[model samples]
Target: MEYKHVVNRIMLMIALFISIFLNLQAQSISDSSTILIQRNLRYADAPLEIGQDTSSDRLLDLYLPHTKPMQSLPILVFIHGGGFSGGDKGAKGNVALCKEIAAKGYAVVSINYYLYLKQNKIQGASAGANMKDGLPKDGKFHTGLETAVKMASADTELALQWIKNHAENYALDTNRLAISGGSAGAMTALYTTYRSKQKILPIRCVVNFWGGLASTDDIRASAPPLLTFHGEQDDLINVAYAYALHKKMKELNIQQSEIHILKNMGHAIYNYITKNEINTIDKFLTSNMPAYE
Candidate 1:
């Protein structure tokens, strides 16, 4: 009897140890990966020779996955939005999204565009030195929504052209490409996706998170599939803009546009305002979209 009891206790200890070991190993495999990408993905940091200052307006950050065997991967370009007046490509907010997308087997690029460079000049409009009209329109540091959109669009087109001329070097599939953005960045993605007439990047789909859409006819013209997420309670860049664009796309018979209006969400879905939206965006990227005709 004593021998049998000892044997049972030993068996129980062995089973517990095995269970703990397996659990830890399973966690190690299920958690974040350790794949390290060691190569610099080819990308031009110069502005398009056509418009804007190449010195300040041109600069792109490319992120590539560390997948072995070097298979050709899809592409995703992200444009950050700081009201188009101030935003950096190196911000943690920008790179976090890029790295997340890259982990899912895609190459990602983040771009920085010219900010509103208006120098403070309290002249003519100062009136009697106490006349406050609105906001300072310093020539060296100023930008509006329309101007920002145009400049960002130009920069994006230039990047697309660069990729088109050198896709093979980057190990990218010319046929599979996508664009995404937050706030002004979202506007940039939509405008860039629809405005261009050339097939430089051949964007397969788009992800617009907390961004507005312009009335650019090209959105309806190309009508590439789009997935947009916006907060219903957004104060800046009203939610109506999203629905308006979707309505127009539908009218133009451009199907395959998905819009997720998160309840009680606000502007800046991926960054400061609403961080949870980033995971939702990731899920969208994971689910493949149907081929465009």
Candidate 2:
């Protein structure tokens, strides 16, 4: 009986030890990831260019997980909104979104593309419109705006090329790339996805925050999944553009696109991507890129 009791005690102790070890292992496995950022990495090869508030700095900030880089991290390239003439890569509000996304194990590349505006006013909407200050229409932005979009789109392509060149060094999975932007930056994202000529980087998803497309006519049935947030009271870019984009995608049978309109809000909805919305965005990415699921 004593020997049997001793054996039972030993088995009980072993079970407890195993349970503790398993708990520790589980905790370690589920440990939160830390993010590390490397800033001011030049992406453009052209002679170092500068713009208002360093807009054409041609630099990009890379955000990655602080772990053993196995060259497997998916990339989410972000552009800032400044009407193509003002914003920089280090804007604080947008940085919050970038960091939060990075913390979820994505490599976020916030880049600086050439700004297209500086005290310049491009034609608003189209000649006939309704909304604020009339129509983008209905019609697309004028030449200056169009040129800015094209230039910014080109620069964004260069940034993708840069990301591809350094993919191995940063554990970036170029095959799984997504681009996002706010306001003008959002327009650039759409341009890069549908208009950019270089096929070096294939975008899986787009998160457009208060951005207007040059024309919904540019999108096709095969375009990437879109997730957009627009403020109905947007004073800069009209909400009609967002509706037009959504309508176009619907017509094309692109079922994965979605739009969220915020009432009484103006432009700059990117700054207000709440925690819930972030989760939704993350889910959108995961769903679009099933590998992340």
Scored by TM-score, the top model is 2
Query: Per-residue CA lDDT of candidate 2, range 70-132, in tens?
Result: 458888999998776577889887788888888777899999877756435455522112234
lDDT of candidate 1 over 1-293, digit per residue (tens): 99999999999999999999999998886444433332233344543342544324566777766554255667788888766556667766776667767766677767776543221232331111211121123311123455556667877777787667767877876677788888777877887777656566677778987776444344655567778777788776667767767776787776667788879767665653233454555555555432334
The estimated TM-scores of all candidates read 0.69, 0.81
Location of the lowest summed lDDT over 10 successive residues in candidate 1: 125-134
Best by lDDT: 2
Task: Give candidate 2 misplaced runs (Cα > 4 Å).
Answer: 1-33, 46-53, 69-71, 119-138
Cα lDDT listed for each candidate? 0.64, 0.79
**Reference-based TM-score, model 2:** 0.81
